[model samples]
Target: MQQLALFIRKEFIHVLRDRRTLLILFGMPVMQILIFGFALSNEVKNARLVVVDHGRDLATAALIARLDASRYFEVEQVALSPPALEATFRRGEVKVAVVFPARFYEQWQHGRDVAVQVIADASDPNTATTLTQYVSAIVYDHATEQREAQALPYGLRVETRMLYNPQLEGAPNYVPGVMALVLMLVCVMMTAVSIVREKETGTLEVLLVSPFRPVLVIVAKAVPYLILSLVNVGTILVLSTTVLHVPVQGNVLLLLAESILFITTCLALGIFISVQTSSQQVAMLISLMGMLLPTILFSGFMFPIENMPVPLQVIAHAVPAKWYYIIVKAIMIKGLGIAAVWKETLVLAGMTAGWLFISVKRFNIRLA
Candidate 1:
């Protein structure tokens, strides 16, 4: 009994001595709980929206007021002309646009059915479809209230039109999500573990001391993984289109270009992880807990970002998968070209550069 107790005590001491391991063990669960509890939600809120009210009458004003009051929408601007509304959507400023016909109020008052056009930026088909539904429900409710007040038999008719994804297919929503998740796991987690394994075998130090520049050594190590990740991207694209029947509506070359960019980002993140940790186990754990969980929960794959608490939403913005997911959906589902998704691309490029810079700096400091 004494021997067993001594063995247990020794193991505990060893565990506690490694503060990084201890911190990871304790911090991972808390992070998962906080993220899953707060950040993971399907409900949409504060969706940026634009309104164009040609009616400009009491009825139109009341409907717009209802939308503004709802938690689901934030009325950002009132577009003066159709071109202005187009500009807003083109700039990615708003996800939804509400357009009321010029004689909307007059038609409603004359006992005729009125139609309010709800145009959604279906780049993210799921968000676009959900926002359209929410707005339509609000419009229907307002029409019902007006009908009751007037003691009318018929109420307003609200028609919703999804711009990019008229069918609202689930594949379009999930394909990009799956791509982001898979690529992150393979590129980041696998590369991190591979690099850490080299360190554990004592070969990484030998390579560092080799005649080749440290940056070249790191790039050489990353090149194989980068190529593998790109092959995986091709496989995903093939499966998404052939087996899943999800069409690549945009330019295929452009999608490949973006995929390469995202793969670079993940590889840099993996290098950063490798630089931080010496143990393969630690690298794997961080990759899974830190990268995988956030990719799934905070990247709009399983939950909408707008539904998360404000602080969590801010954190979601930092997740690389979030931007890549948006880019994929915009390209694959919306058929939007690089022009429409330039901001997301830029953000991802910046993240990649930042991760690489930090990794290089840390690697140099460790060597010094």
Candidate 2:
């Protein structure tokens, strides 16, 4: 018993001495709890809403006020023409839009039939559905109040149009998210581990001393994983189309180009991790643990980024997967062109360049 206790105490002291191990033990759980608590919300909040009120009357204004007053919506009443409204959706500016036809209240007052269209960007089916239901509920409550005041049933029909995904299937959202998660973890894990193994075995120093440049060495190390990751991308796309039936709505070649760009970004991140760490175990741990939570939580994969606190949303913008996820959804689900996703593409490209710059810089310092 004494020997066992002494052995246990020695192990605990050794664990306490390693700051990285200690951080993984104590720091990780607290961070995960806080992030999941804040980020994992099903209820909609502060969803951007645009109201096109052709009516421009008292009833329409009252309904708009009610929408703005609700916690779920940030309502903006705009006189957008039909084409401009569609362009707004394609640009991913607003989540939901309410269109009240001309003389909405006038028709209601005359006991004539009328319809108010609720248009939502349904690329993220869950959020689109929730926002639509919230709108419906609000409209229903307004109708009920009018019925009571007039002592007659004033029926107001809420017609919901879920753009890009009329049926609201789960595949369209999850497939893009899964692509982000898989590529990030796999590419980062493999590239980091391979290079770290070289370092651990003292082979990396030989390569750095070789005729080829150190930056070339790092890129060479990442090339195999890049190829493998592209294979993974192809496999995922095939399954998504064949099994899940979620077709690529945009240019296939464009989607492939974006996927390659994102893969390169992940490889650059892996190189950075490899240059920072000295052990294969540590590199693997960092690649798996470091990328997993951020990719899942901050990438807007499992949760809505807007629902998180401001600090968390700021953290999300730093995540490369968040930009890539948005790009994938735009291309794969919404059929949007490069014109709509150039900003996100630029972000991923910048991140790749940044990570590679830092990695090459650090690798040179180690060589010196």
Query: Which number leads on TM-score?
Result: 2
lDDT of 1: 0.79
Alpha-carbon lDDT, every model: 0.79, 0.81
Off by over 4 Å in 2: 1-154, 365-368
lDDT of 1 at 355: 97
Candidate 2: residue 148 Cα off by (Å)? 23
lDDT of 2 by residue, 1-368 (tens): 45344533543464457686445434443343333334544567899999999999988988899999998899998999999999999999999999999988889888676799999999999889999989998987887687678777545545567899775556677778878887888778767876777787787687666565676667666665566567667767776788667889999999999999999999999999998888988998999999999998999868899999999999999999999999999999999999999999999999999999998888853542
What's the CA error at residue 226 for candidate 1, in Å? Answer: 1.1
Query: Backbone clashes per model, in order?
Result: 0, 0
Among all candidates shown, the one with the greatest lDDT = 2
How would you encode candidate 1's per-residue C-alpha lDDT over 1-368 as one tens digit per residue? 45344533543464457676445434433343334333544457799888888888888888888999988899854756778778778899889988899988889998787889999998889789899988988988888788879888853455677887565445567778878877787678766876787778877677677555667656766766666567667766776677657789999999999999999999899999998998999999998889888998999978889998999999999999999999999899888899999999999999999999998888752343
